[model samples]
Target: MKEGPNIAAIAALIGDPARANMLQALMTGVALTASELAQEAGVTPQTSSFHLSRMADAGLVSLRKQGRHKYYSLADADVAALLEAMSGIAMRSGMTRVRTGPREPELRKARVCYNHLAGEYGVQAYDSLIAREFLVEEDEKLVLSSSGRSFFTDLGLVLPSNETKRRPLCKSCLDWSARRSHLAGITGTALLSFFFDQGWAKRVEGSRVIQFSKAGDSRFHEAFSLQN
Candidate 1:
């Protein structure tokens, strides 16, 4: 018997089509009820509950209770990162869905991967940070430079002290659509929060899409020094 981790078991759990749909829907970083997940997965609520129970037991998802209602989300950033990486592999392998919808274009433009920005705009932001030397690669890991600290502080982004946190301050996530790395980890979350707080972008209802208004779009490009 193999002595390492049982990846096959986890893969089997995620291999189901209905559960995959439910999991993808939660990638928006939104907690969802079983009924909502049922709608997303095209399954009955009872079936959704069963799937949710299995996922919960496997630590792939976390559940929250609000009064009499229960909501579920991906367990943590790790799960989201895994899903995103899998998506990129599927895309590269041409395992795409047959039907493309209008939302496809919007999703490719800008969307949320868990709590951080992803897609084309996300790649642009990461590139800008690298180009401006706000972030640097050291020991094969993304590190926030001293200039990055000052840059973020000047932008009113309150960064968490590294000594107090278990998560890295800077990390890179591979964007599925753009096929490039984007910012992730603590700094990435802070940056996305800053955008929301400043009203530079907003999440689209019932989707992962992060829509930037015209003025907000301009501001984001100007701030990141992205080409028009």
Candidate 2:
């Protein structure tokens, strides 16, 4: 018997089509009820409950109770990161869904990955930060430079002085659609919140797409020094 982690068991849990759909739907970073997840999975409520129970036991998903209603979300950033990495592998392998929609372009342009920005703009942001030396690679890990601290602070983001053991301040996430690295972690989450707070972008209802207004789009490019 293999002594290491049982990846096969976790893979089997995620391998089911209905559960996969439900998990993907939660990638929007919104807590969903079993009924909502059932709709997303295209399964009956009872089936959704069963899958949720299994996932909850496996620590793949977390559940919360709001009054009489129960809501579920991915366990943590690790689960989201795993799903994103898997998506990149699937895309590279040409294992794509046959059904494509008009929103595909929008999704590729800008979308939410868990709690952080992803897609084209997300990739561009990471690239720009690296190019400007705002983020530097050291020992194969991302480190926010002193200049990066000033940059974000000037932009009205409060940078953390000490890194938490539980979550990173700066980390790279693989973008499935752009096929590149994007910012993820506490800083990334803060940046996305800043955009929404400043009205630079807004999340589309019932979807992961982030719609930037015309002025907001211009400002985003200018702020990130993204070439037109």
Candidate 3:
């Protein structure tokens, strides 16, 4: 690599299967300890720490110490976005491994992508919002309309006054499983939190799945008019 940004370095780091697994696990937006990551990577704790150290040095992962244990998470939403994009390309290109996991179906139905909702329900919500004029696309960017503000407020989600201005109010993230766009950014994060607060869904332990109860699922579909 010359004196420029080197994607090859990042690619090489993520190319290892164990490291890839660790990164995928972090896509759930949960900080995991070295031992927990080792279990996900099918590696020993020492090896997990070694791999984690390299990724952290490369800005692929970030670590925080809680008590005596250090928990690791993706460095940022950009890293998670990159991995999600890669997964889409791999699936579209037929480069996927055979025999998806038992949880794969649930994941495809609904899951968390970093700090936002993803999969079928997420896609539906994004589409519905656009159709209802809650959001608009302009100049390759998602813009939350004035109606969107009212809609979200009615749902009991008020935009924080001190929310970081660096992040957009609305953004689109490509869903890996659905191969479609899902809402992201500050608004997306707020909506997902709203779902939890409304008791519409809960995160599955040790996984990325967001399981909605029967009534919750019905309410979700009705609220979003996703009965297509």
Candidate 4:
């Protein structure tokens, strides 16, 4: 057999189906309890615990102990990126291209990226800004324009408290499924928060999927011109 990229280590870590599911859940960035994750993977708590323990030992996940509950999340942002990339490859390799039943449209819409927005809506938002010349994309990095500053200012999202406000505004990250660059970095996070503040989106309780209410839907459609 021909050899592949030097990812035997990562391949092994993700090779376990149960561990893979746990990693997918953590990709959403919320710390999930063992039980919640167990349900997600359709495994018993003990099975999930075993998988989580293995992942935690591998440094793929971080474990936190509260007063009682133990919460698990991706070890860091890099871990999330790694998982996303792995998912992208899996999709391209025809690992999960088939869905026998109806797919959940909301999932491919606005969803959490660790702590920010991602998915089709995400791609559209970033694209609209680029189309309008409010944000410039160059070499996968975004530098906000004068109009961008004014845009956010009028939207009521002040610049974050950075010692040097010269930080790059937005960064383009490759979306695993969409095969396009979506927004990331400080600008991306702030804009997501702005959407929430402006009532353009709301988080579904106990879940990371964001659903746009009527006002929010209209606002998002008007602001970014996203196709349903």
lDDT scores of the candidates, listed in order: 0.92, 0.94, 0.92, 0.76
lDDT of candidate 4 over 1-228, digit per residue (tens): 868765677678788777887777776778999999998888999999988888888778899999999999998766776776776777788888467233346766777777667888888888887887888856745778888778778767786534233334566766777877778777777878888888788877655578888988787768776433
Error of 1 at 177 (Å): 0.4
Q: Per-residue lDDT tens digits of candidate 3, residues 84-103?
A: 99999999999887888899
Ranking according to TM-score, highest score first = 2, 1, 3, 4
Off by over 4 Å in 2: none
Weakest 10 consecutive residues of candidate 2 by summed lDDT: 219-228
TM per candidate: 0.96, 0.98, 0.95, 0.82
lDDT of 3 at 62: 100
| Whole-model lDDT, model 2 | 0.94
Off by over 4 Å in 4: 1-6, 97-103, 161-169, 205-208, 225-228
Arranged by lDDT, best first: 2, 1, 3, 4
Clashes of each: 0, 0, 0, 0
Q: What is the lDDT of residue 203 in candidate 3?
A: 98
lDDT of 2 by residue, 44-148 (tens): 999999999999999899999999999999999999999999999999999988986889999999999999999999999999999999999999899999999
2 or 4, greater by lDDT: 2
> Which structure among the candidates has the greatest lDDT?
2
The TM-score between candidate 4 and the true structure equals: 0.82
- Positional deviation of 222 in candidate 3, in angstroms? 1.8
Clashing pairs in 2: none
Model 3, residue pairs in steric clash: none
Q: What is the lDDT of residue 188 in candidate 4?
A: 78
